[model samples]
Target: MTDPARSALMSKVKGKNTRPELIVRQELHALGGRFRLHRKDLPGRPDIVMPSRKLAVFVHGCFWHRHQNCRMASTPKTRQGFWNEKFDANIARDQRNAFDLQQLGWRVEVIWECQTRKREQLSASLKKLLVPPENHR
Candidate 1:
């Protein structure tokens, strides 16, 4: 695709309410997890926040967040330099946000887009996330 075509395609991509995000949101609701969406006051405006639990969840796209060993996280065939820099910045920002959230006493969990593909596995993981540790119980 030409540069203009690529730009237009990328422009259509949304910042929120993406397919993976919707899947996660639906599952969370099914699992009885109540969360606030994208609280601007929080660092990185986490996708889901449970204030009572002091937990923040981020539903990250594999390509944008550079998920390790994920097929969906392939680098673009064109613009290697630009993509690398963009991916690097995104990773850095994610790290910074996670660190900030932790410092503020919030436990953070990141759910990759690929993980949501398998409903059973995702449900198990979500159960673990929503459940307090045995010691806490």
Candidate 2:
């Protein structure tokens, strides 16, 4: 593809309220998880912030965030150098943001895009994260 076409496509890719993010939001609502969106005060402006639980959730795109062991996180065939640098920067920024949030006493959770593709698994994971673990005695 030409540079113009690629640029146009990239421009169409949104930063917030993406389809994957929306899915997570809906699931969280269904599970009765009350949260705030993109708190500017927080590092990296987490997608979902539950102040009551002191937890911040980041909905990450597999390809963009370079989810480990995820097939969807593969590098693009074109612009190898550019993509590598972008992925590396994204990973670094994510690590820095998570660290900052943790330092400020906020628990951080990252839900990858590919994970959200499976409704059942995603629901289970969300429950696990949002719900307190039961004592097995």
Candidate 3:
């Protein structure tokens, strides 16, 4: 069912504008928030970076980033060990990246593809990222 040509074409595609990225970006825009997309100076080149708030957002694919307890996360029947290590490394690195950003005094937000795919919950989840409760008013 997979088209070889399309698959080959898709493999070359990377960076933001992915489905999850677009979804999150659209919702964030609706909230009237502005951010830089993938600034190279950052360690991870976070998907959405706001210098004013020192905030970073990462839009993660459930399958690729190995979302914990997600059905989409599956090891290939072949080379299971390699996949496992890669998945574990990704998770570990993700943690490290967020920790490093935090150490630099940045507030990090991670949006999982699985979470964003839920249409009913996407707005609320995205809003939570863009707006933290204000201490005043």
Candidate 4:
């Protein structure tokens, strides 16, 4: 694709309220998970925050966050150096944010974009994640 075309496509990509994030939010709500959106006070402004549970959720796109071993994380044919640097920076930032949140006594969970593609699976996963270990029995 041409530079202009690529630029337009990239611009259309949203940083918040993305389809995956919305799907995750809906599933979480259906599972009775009350949460807040993008709490600015938090280290990385988590996509979903369950204050009572002290949990922070980040809905990350596989490509942008470079999900390990995920098909969607494939690099572009062009701009190898640029993409690598960008991906590295994103990963570093994600690690820093998770570390800071952990230090603050908050649990951090990452919900990948591909994981939200199936409603049933997403629901089941959310249920498992939300349940406290003590209540597992």
TM-score of each: 0.95, 0.93, 0.84, 0.95
RMSD of 1: 1.5
What order do candidates take by TM-score, descending?
1, 4, 2, 3
For residues 82-133, write the lDDT of model 1, one tens digit per residue: 9999999999999999999999989999999999999999999898888875
Name the Cα RMSD for model 2. Answer: 1.9
Candidate 3 C-alpha lDDT tens digits along 1-137: 25687569758777677988988888878878888899888878899987876889999988779887989877667667977898899988889989888888888888888888786698887666666535314
Please give the TM-score that candidate 3 achieves against the real structure: 0.84
Residue 116, candidate 2: how far off, in angstroms? 1.0
Q: List the residue pairs that clash in candidate 2.
A: none
Candidate 1 colliding pairs, count: 0
- Model 2, 37-127: lDDT tens digits are 9999999999999998888999999889998898988887998998999899999999999999999999899999998889999999888
lDDT of 4: 0.95
The TM-score measured for candidate 4 stands at 0.95
Q: Which candidate, 2 or 4, would have the higher lDDT against the true structure?
A: 4
lDDT of each: 0.93, 0.91, 0.81, 0.95
Error of 3 at 81 (Å): 1.0
RMSD of each predicted structure:
1.5, 1.9, 3.4, 1.3
What are the runs in model 3 whose C-alpha is more than 4 Å off?
Answer: 1-13, 133-137
Give, for candidate 3, the lowest lDDT window spanning 10 residues.
128-137
